[model samples]
Target: MAEAFTIRYIQPLWFIWVIIAVYIVFYAVFNHTEINVGAYWFAVITIAYILISAFVNPRDEMYASIIGMPLGILWAMYERKIDSYFEIGFLRKEIVAIVAFVILFIGRLTLSVVGFDNQLFQSVLRNIITIAFIVPLIELLKKVKIQKRFLIWLGTISYEIYIIHPFILYFFEKETTEGKQVGNLEIVLWTIGLTLLLSSVLQIVQDNLVRKVKL
Candidate 1:
């Protein structure tokens, strides 16, 4: 498996040119608000230069492109060692859950007392937190797993995870939102549990679809 991944490091120069051209086209199209004819032409010229450099210095190009990622990860580890126990000290999952419950309960009481009605603010904050913390943590956790097969399978089914989540949200969203708002423990648990359960099942279906296409 390692050897298979290593082989991709020597992809043909033509593919690099193809990548550069496609990038120029897509970037120009996406940035039409700022990209004028001169800017587009300059971008094309710059992309050509990058491709030329890649072809002329294949090893350097390959290392510059891929090597920095792992090095950056190692540098992060060097700065802050992973002390999971210390980080999560005295707080088991259940304790953490209880803490979250207490915080939400207090927040609800405070909001009622203050007569605050900022549903939009709450929704925006939830989205910001999910994108900033949850999504990145999920991706980092995925990388830490030592199982190659697990990662491969996850990669295969990630599209389904992304696509099916909206449908699941649409179906259970009202009940889930109401439960959370009312601080209903049972509904909160059931919503999370069902979402995960259904998402996993959908992943399997997506994997089958991917296999059919690849085969």
Candidate 2:
């Protein structure tokens, strides 16, 4: 809902790079204190999710109940012209974007140093950082193409995928070794195959249901 707005806008590589730089600045707030990069990454995934979860929208850290529901209603109320919000002169200002980036960067850096190394404190701090930068990130992402097909497909079934994917993963893991590492590429392919198959069927069923209700 937030990101559907900037698709046709000009997004230079530098623009994308600047956004990456912003995210890094925001991220480094928690990270620069730690000298080891590998340990830093290990900490990000300390939540016991599968490796693919970090990159998959169905498994993204953000949730529909938390993020999707309100946005869904808002997108409806706006009649899907939510992208036009970017047309505001203040929001489109380069200086506004830069200030947003720097404030986010400095705030996080300050938090990182002041908060020290407490994990719970850092988690709360990161959420604060997200509050500072999420607007700019969404502003930047709509113009950028991370994975066009995946984004479109996920956008279409964004709510459903979150619910369906867990079940797919549960069954796939259940039928397999369950506890051991899945080292086979074929097994990974099978997971992909199953997700596509099941998700397509679900989408079809959902479309039929929506059509019946005229929604």
Error of 2 at 162 (Å): 3.0
Q: How many Å off is the CA of 59 in candidate 1?
A: 54
Where does the lowest 10-residue lDDT sum fall in candidate 1? 62-71
Clashing residue pairs in candidate 1, if any?
none
Across residues 1-215, which tens digit of lDDT does each residue of candidate 2 receive? Answer: 22354533222122233233333432443344442442334334332222233345443233212222223224444633545666566355535766876786687678778856444444445554454455556656676777778778766775455445555565556656457666568666776677667777777876764444312
- Candidate 2: C-alpha lDDT: 0.48
Candidate 2: deviation at residue 52, Å?
32
- Looking at model 2, which ten-residue stretch has the lowest summed lDDT? 63-72
TM value for model 1:
0.27
* Candidate 1 residue spans exceeding 4 A from truth: 1-115, 135-143, 155-159, 165-215
lDDT of 1 by residue, 14-33 (tens): 33333334444434443443
In model 2, the clashing pairs are none
> After superposition on all CA atoms, how large is the RMSD of candidate 1?
19.1
- The candidate maximizing TM-score is 2
Model 2: how far residue 159 lies from native, Å: 4.3
